[model samples]
Each structure stands twice: as C-alpha cells, then as structure tokens.
Target: VTLSDLDPPNAYRISGEGSGGVAGYAKGGALVRLESESADVTVLHYDVDAQIGGKLAQLGARLINSTATKLAGEFFKSFADVVSAKAEAS
Candidate 1:
C-alpha cells in the first residue's frame, strides 16, 4: 500500500508499505520540507521509527552554519547572542 500527504510550507510526506512473503511487511516514509523563502532550501528525510527496523530506517536532521553556508542566515548568531547576554547577566 502507498500513501501520500501534503504538509505545511510545501512539505510532502510520502509513505509506502510492502510484504516480502517470509520477511514480513515493511513500511516507511519520506518527507521533504520545502522552504518558503527564496533563500531557503528544501530538507529531505526518511521516517524510521514508523518502520520495522527503526534505527536503520531513521533519517537524521542537522542545522549547520559556516562562512559559506547556513540554513538560517544569522539565526544561529542571534541565538548565540541571546545566550551570551543571559550568561553575562547571570
């Protein structure tokens, strides 16, 4: 069986299920979070816990910011600033 659905921000959740006779039925999903802004990007992931082999089917998500690349420009920097201010006050 196959299922598909649309989420917010143009994200898509695609899922499927299949049986391997002796092995049993397997189910999984792929999700893509598309950015709304022109500078944003689309993030892709596979839902694992919803599968038989939970860990193996899992997809990891990460947010990174470098001199050349950043998913949220200045977002991390602003967050750090807030933390630093709080720490200084403490």
Candidate 2:
C-alpha cells in the first residue's frame, strides 16, 4: 500500500493495487480522519472501498463482504489498542 495525502494528526489516505495470488484479484483503499471531540476524546471516521475480480469474485459478494468487514474491525481494534498503550506510556 502507498500512503499519501497526509495531514498530520488529522487525516491520511492509503491506496494500493492488488499483487499476487488471491490478492491479485482485488484492489482496495481507505481514508481515515480524526476529529477531536474533547480534551480526552477523539473521533475516527473512515471510508473503505474494494474491487474484486478473477476467481476470488466467484466466492460470492456476501462472503467477500463479510471477510472485509471482519478485517477492518480487527484493524481498528488493534490500532486503538496501540494508541491507548502509547498514550499511557507518555
């Protein structure tokens, strides 16, 4: 993936083309933004998109969509855990 259009402490975008095996059958991107809500809280807004082709697409939209959703959830949860740990360390 390539990281671009970055605005530190606020927003960034990540985009990339598919490469190799099952990955070669798909391409995806994400946009993530952070908005401060209060002294101790911040809100994260994200948009994700994916396009699938080849044999992978034959797996049906329901399966593919659910897998993507699960991955995204795990990603954000892991991100939050890391950030929380860093804040505590600071």
Candidate 3:
C-alpha cells in the first residue's frame, strides 16, 4: 500500500496491490479527505476492491485475521517510508 502527493491540510490518495497466493491478485486505490479537525484530525474514507479470478474458486471459509493484521502493519510502515522519502526529496 502507498500514500502519495500528500497535499497537506486537505487530502491524500492511497494505492496498493495485493496477492492471495494461488487464489488471486488484486489492486486497489482510494482517496482520503480530511473532514474534521481539532487537536487531532479525522478523515473521510473511500476504497476500491478488485480481483483477478472468478468467485467460484473460493472454497474454504477460514479467517486469517492475525496474518492480515501483520501484513497490513508492514504495508503501512512501508507506505510511510515511501512517502517520507518523497517528501524529503521535495
């Protein structure tokens, strides 16, 4: 996942790619708007979902929540690093 062009005091865009191993691969993007603020800021969210395969291929009904959480955390850090580097360059 990645966030870029963080035009501060307003909004940002997040773009990402995901692969579900033998299942499928997906990529998504969304824009986040800062709708409210105080000492802390609140964001309005948006998301997109897309896949590379048919629905019938999903057979199991298992939830790997921990794995998902870990991966998401890693992705968030990576995204932060990428955006930080870009900001530094500018």
Candidate 4:
C-alpha cells in the first residue's frame, strides 16, 4: 500500500496491490477529497478503482461488491459519529 499526493486538510490518494489464496489478487486506488460546505460542515468525496483476478473474480463479483459497499457505508457512518462527538465536546 502507498499513500501519496497529499493536500493537507483537504485531499489525498491511496493505492495498493496484493494477492491471497481464496481472494486471489487485486489492485486498487482511491482519491479522497474534502470540501467545505459550511463553517461546521465538510463533505467527503471519494473515487475508487479496483480490479479483481483469479478465483475471486471468477466466483462472485456481486457478493464482493456488495460487501465492499456495506463496509464503506459503515466506515463513513462511524467517522461521522466520531467527528460529531469531537465537535460537541469542543
């Protein structure tokens, strides 16, 4: 994995590649940007690209996609909760 093209307090890009037994091999990258909507609101935008190969790709792409989507949703929800808590504490 690699983290680069950082724009402090605003954006960044991440990329990685790996291989496993059941999961096979995969490579992907994401560009994440933060945009200020208001004094107290910031919106995050992300673009991701991934390629799956070998057994995993041949097995079930739908299942893999849905799981990834679910995980991303959960991650953002948790992130929002933490951010809100910190703002309230401040």
Candidate 5:
C-alpha cells in the first residue's frame, strides 16, 4: 500500500517498494508497535524490510543491501523520534 494506517500498540505486517528512478532507490518500511511499559516508558517492537530491485538491484546485492540498510535506518530513526515526542506529550 502506498499509504498506511499504522495504529500503534498492535502488531502489523508491512511491505512496499520504492521509486526506482533514483540511484539509491530502495523499498523500506516496518511493522512496528509502541507498547506501554509503565506510566513513564514505552517499548517499540519492530520488524523492518528494505529492498532494491530493477536497475537498482542490478547494482549487485551488496550495494542494494547497503543502500536499503541506510534508508531503513533513517526511516526508523525519524519515525521513532516522532513517536517518542507523541508519547511524551500524552
């Protein structure tokens, strides 16, 4: 799905491909949840996938994997930051 409805505190299945027009194009996203650990803490559980295909994948698996890894890491970092801020405000 191009857009997702990710309601936290519940597990989910995630997958997608990215636009391949760019050099570092990758498919990257995650299945994640924020579970309350206590009144002051929340835990994130996640499984993430990042893929590169078409001309991007032709660059070899190592290149694709590396690019995907970076993309996924950035994505999760940004996502977590947003979630963390939201939790703190609640």
Candidate 6:
C-alpha cells in the first residue's frame, strides 16, 4: 500500500496492487477519513479494478471481493485492539 494523498490530519487516500488466491492480479485504492481529536477512522471507499485491462473478466469478482473483505475485517479487528491497548497503557 502507498499513501496517495493526505489532507492534514483528517483524510488520506491509499493505493495498492497485488495477486491473491482467486488466480490473477488486482489493483485497488481506499479513501480514509479521521475524526478530529478522536480515535475514529473510517474507510469511505474501497475500489478494486483488474490490473490487466480494468475488468474482472475471468477472475471471479465475488471470490476476490470476499477475500479482500475478510482480510480487511481481520486487519481492522487487530488494529482496533492494538489502539485500545495503547490507550489503556497511556
């Protein structure tokens, strides 16, 4: 993942590309927004596109989407737990 853009302390967009269990390669980006003076972070958008020619022609879209969704959920769960632990420590 790479940080494509940032707006001070409130917003940012990231871009990344990789291959997964579904067969071929994919590219996507996300827009993240942060609440002021708070720990809340939201993903406003997550978009995926075929790396070859911008279409999920052969590599089933549902399968790839499901995998990405599952991974994102796991990541957020771990991330939130870490943040909570740090807050408790502080």
* Ten contiguous residues minimizing lDDT sum, candidate 4: 64-73
Predicted model with the maximum TM-score: 4
TM-score of model number 5: 0.55
The CA lDDT at 81 in model 2 is 88
Residues 20-53, candidate 6, lDDT per residue (tens digit)?
5445567766566655444544333334332322
The 10-residue segment of model 5 with minimum total lDDT is: 1-10
Task: Estimate candidate 1's alpha-carbon lDDT, on a 0 to 1 scale.
Answer: 0.45
The local distance difference test score of each candidate is 0.45, 0.79, 0.55, 0.81, 0.69, 0.61
Native-referenced Cα lDDT, model 6: 0.61
- Give the Cα error of residue 70 in candidate 5, in Å: 2.0
lDDT (10s digit) by residue, model 5, range 1-90: 553655644555566765856564667666777687888776767666667666667768686666666776787789889978997888
- What tens digits encode model 4's per-residue C-alpha lDDT throughout 1-74? 79899998999997888898777987777788899999999988777667788898999766776676566667
Least lDDT summed over 10 consecutive residues: which range in candidate 3?
54-63
Please give each candidate's TM-score.
Answer: 0.39, 0.78, 0.40, 0.80, 0.55, 0.65
Give the clash total for candidate 2: 0
RMSD of each: 14.4, 2.4, 7.0, 2.0, 4.0, 4.7
Order the candidate numbers by lDDT, best to worst: 4, 2, 5, 6, 3, 1
Worst 10 residues of 6 by lDDT: 44-53
Candidate 1 or 3, higher TM-score? 3
- Residue 40, candidate 3: Cα error in Å is 8.6
- Please give the clash total of every predicted structure, in order: 0, 0, 0, 0, 0, 0
For model 3, residues 35-69, the per-residue Cα lDDT tens digits are: 66454434343433333433313542222333444
**Runs off by more than 4 Å, candidate 4:** 21-23
- Runs in model 2 deviating more than 4 A are 20-24
